[model samples]
Target: MASDLLIAQPDEGPVLDLAGDLSLVLPSDFPRIVKPFAIEAHSRMLWSELKQPLTPWLLMLGFEDVDPKPPWLLPGLRDLQALLWLAEQLDHKINSSGDGVVTVVLPPATQALAMLQLARQGPELLDSLWDPLLTWWTETRRKLSHFDRMLRLQLPAADALRPPEVWRRRLQTLSTCLNNPAHSELVLALIGDAARWPVLRRRCALMPLNSLPLSRIVLQGQGWTMIPLSDSGLPILITARDGLDQRDAIRQWWGSASTPPPSVHWGRGDQQGRLTLTCRVFAPGVEKADLRITCRDQKLEISALEQRLHIPLPEECHGFTPLSARVKGVCIEIEFR
Candidate 1:
C-alpha cells in the first residue's frame, strides 16, 4: 500500500495530518518494493518542501537515504536539475557577503558529495567555492586565512589532496593538470605576489656557480708576478705570494706541484646548473694540520698555506671537499667522507 507522508514545518514538531494508506517497510526493502517511485518521491519531496519552513523534519528524512545505491537508482534528469538549482541558490546566499562560508543546508554526507562532484566538473566551480571562502576568511575567519589551513579544514580526506604533489614530478603534468603557468600566476596574484611566496623566493635566491662573473687574480714568483689564466671550470684556485726569504721554499714546492694540481678534480653530479670540484692533499711526515681557505664569488684566497702543507692524508679516497667556501650570499664547508 502507498503511504501518504506528511512533512511538517522544519522548526515545528511532527506531522499534523496523515490521509493515505500506510505501508511501513525496512529501508533495505525500499529499492525493491518502491521501484522508481521512492527516488521520484525523494526528489519531489526535497524540491517541494525545500522552500517551506520544514527544517528538522526534512533534514531527518534526507539523512535516512544515505546508502550505496545503483547508479540507475540515482534521481532522474529532472531531479538533477532540481538539485543543481538548490545548490546554486544555497551557493548564492553563502557568497552574497563575499565571505567564503556558504550556509549549505543538506544532509551532511550529501553536502560533501555534492561539493566533490562540483570540484570535479571544473576549476571554475572550485574557484567559485574557494573565492568565497577566501573572502570570508580574510574578512571574518582571520585564523584560517592561509591556503594550507583552508585546505586542511575543507578536504578532510587525505587521499583526495594527493594529486598535485604526485603529478608534479613531470613538467607536462605540472603544465597540464597541476600548476599551469597561467594558474600559478593567478594564485601568486591572489596570495599578494611572487615575493610573498617564501618557498618560491628561496628557490630564486640560489645563484648558479657557473653564472658568477669572473675576477682578476695575481700569482707571485721570485722576482716577478704573473697573472695566470683563470680557470672557469674549477670553482677554487689558490694563489700564493711569497716574501724574498720564502721564494726558494716556494720554488721547491712549485717544482713538485702537478700542472693541474694533484689535489684538484672536476665533474658533474645530480643537481643541474652546477659542477663539482674535488680536492685532496697527501704527503709523508706531515703533522695533520688543518687547511684554511676562503672563497669569494670569483676568487679564492689561501691563508696559512704552511699549515695545509703539514696535513696528513688517508691511503685512498674519492669525494668532494670545500676549503672554506663562500658564494655571493651563502657559505658552506662541504666534505664528503
Candidate 2:
C-alpha cells in the first residue's frame, strides 16, 4: 500500500504527519542521513511554491518494480546512470540496497522532476508517480468534503472560550489555505476543539445506527427506536418515543412500509458448475401473482403484482450469462454460467 504524509506549513516550519499507518520498507542498511535531507529539501521546495504561511499539502509514495530483463535502451540507461551520479554528488555513501531493480519510495515531486529532466528517459517513471498521486489527491479531497460538512453543520456551544466566530474564522483560514482541505494538523485541531465545546462534543458522539438487522431482531434504545436501511443501503434516522413497547412502536412506524423487502441470496454451485441466484419474495398480496424475471444491460429486473425491483449486477458478475430461470416456492432461482 502507498504511504501518505500530510505537510502543513506552520509558522515554525513544515510539520509532517503520517496520514495512515506508517510501514516503511527501507533497505536493511538504509542511509539514515539521506532520508532527512530529502524530506527537508522537498518540504522547502513545496513550501516555496505554495507561498502561503499555513498551507496544507499531501504526499503519497510507493515502491514498484518494472518488468525484469527490461529493454534498457541507450538513453534510458544513461538516465539511470545520471540518477546514480547525482546521488554520489551529494557525498552520500551508496550501497547495494535490496534487489536494486525495484523502485524505492524516493522523494515524491523532486524525484519525478529529476528523472523526467532526462530528455530521453522512458516515460515509465513519470507515469508511475503521476497516476497514484492523482488518485490519492482525489480520495483525499473526498474525505475533506465529508469532514467539512460535519464541522459546518454542528456548531460549538456559546459558553466555550473559543466562540463560534473563532471557529468560523479558523475554518475560513483553512479554506483559504487549501482549495480542498484535508490537512492532518487542521483536522486534529478541529477534533480537539470538539472536545472543548460541549454542544459540538455531544453532536460528534455518533452512534452506530448503520447496522444490518438480522433475523427478526430490532434494536431498542432508551426510547422505542429502530434503524432501518433505505433502498440505497444508507441508514435512515431513528424514530422513537418514550414509554412505548419497542415492537409495537416499530409496527406503527412500519405501517404501510411493513411489507418485507425481496431478498436475493447466492446458492451453491450446481452439477454443471453454474452459480445460482435465488430471490425470495414473500410479501402479502403478491404470492398469487406471476413473477417475471429478466436481466438487461447488466441489471436484473423482477416484476410481480405491479411492483418492480431493479438490482445492479456487481463487477464480479459481469460477463456471466443467465442459463435458466425458474420459480420454486417463494424463490425465483436463476442460474448463471
Candidate 3:
C-alpha cells in the first residue's frame, strides 16, 4: 500500500534567533523551569520520512525561495549554538560590567535554549538570572513539550517526497543503484538508476541529481492548476493531494507515475525488403489507435500493436529519425533517441 504524505504546516514551531540579544539575559520576572533535549541530531529516528525519495507524488517542503528550513528537519546544533553563544556573551558582560543588564524579550525556542544553558554553571554568581531562566524553561515546555518530545513533534513536510514503499521492491532487486538505499542520496541514487530508463533518463537530464525541482497543483475557483517551480521549461513534476493525471495534461510527465509516450520497436526483416514496426499506440479520445509514420520520401500506417505494419523505409535508415504525431492535442515525438 502507498503511504500518504504528511506535510508540516508553516506556523507550527518557532525558529531560534541570536544576534544582539546574545549579550542579553532575562530579568528577574522571567520563568525558572527548564526541560531536557538531546544535543545530537537524530535524523533517521526523528525525521525518518524525509529519507524518502523525490518521487512525482511527493512534495518537497524546505528550501522554498521564501521559507526557512522546516522545523521537523530542524537540527539542535543551530539552536544549541545560539543558546551557548548568548550564554558566553552574557558571562563576559557579567564579568566586565560590574552591574550588567540584558534584554528580556525573546521567543520560546530561545528561552528553552537559554534554560538549558543557564543550568550549566555559575549558579551562585548568576542567581539573579535563575528566576527568569527557569521560568522561561517551564513556560516554553508548557507549549513546545520537553526537549526530546519537542524534537519528535517538529516534523518536516513530505509533499515533495515519495514514500519508501514506492520503490522498495525494485530497490531490493539488486539490479539497480537503488539496491541499497544507503548507497547514496535517495534522489541521486534514483537518478543513477534512471540512467537505465530511456524516458526517465531524458527527464533526469533536465536537472542535476542534487537539484530536483518541485511542482504543485493549486486549486483555482473551480478547477486545479499545476504550477511549475522552475522557469527553465523542463518537465514539471507534479505531486499534489488532489486532481487526476488528466487534469494536468499540458504538463510534461516527469515523475514516477508519469506515462511513457507512444513508441515503436523496429523488428529485423527476413531479407524480403520488409521490416515490422511494432507500435504501442496511445492517443486522444479513442479506445484503440494506430500510428501514422512519415519520412521525407514516404509515409506508412501501423494499425496493429505487436503484429502489424510490415513496411519499408525510404532508404532503410539506421539510427533514430525524428517522427512527429499529435495525441490528445499534444505533439508527441516518436523517436526514443
Taken over the whole model, the C-alpha lDDT of each candidate is 0.28, 0.34, 0.30
**Candidate 1's residue-wise lDDT over 172-253, tens digit each?**
3222321222221110001112233333222121111111111211122222232122222212122233322343433343
What's the lDDT for candidate 2? Answer: 0.34
**Candidates sorted by TM-score, best first:** 2, 3, 1
Clashes of each: 7, 0, 18
RMSD of 3: 26.3
Summing lDDT over every window of 10 consecutive residues in candidate 1, give the lowest-scoring window: 1-10
Write model 3 residue lDDT over 117-219, tens digit each, in one string: 3323322223353355556545654665565365664332232233233222322221122122232111111111212333332223222211112122111
Question: Which pairs of residues clash in candidate 1, taking residues 3 or more apart in a chain or in different chains?
Answer: 9-54, 10-53, 10-54, 10-55, 100-132, 100-133, 100-136
Name the candidate, 1 or 3, with the larger TM-score value: 3
Candidate 1 segments exceeding 4 Å error: 1-83, 91-101, 105-111, 119-337
Expressed as tens digits, the lDDT of each residue in 1-337 for candidate 2 is 1211111111222222122112343234422222222333443443343333222221112212222232344544433433433333222221323221111222332233334234122233333534565566566656666665776533222122121232233333323322221221111111112123332222111111101111121222233222322231222223232444344444443232222233455554645565544433222212333456778898777665444656677666678766666655434566666
The regions of model 3 sitting more than 4 angstroms off are 1-320, 323-325, 328-337
Error of 3 at 126 (Å): 50
Candidate 1 residue 249 Cα shift, in angstroms, is 78
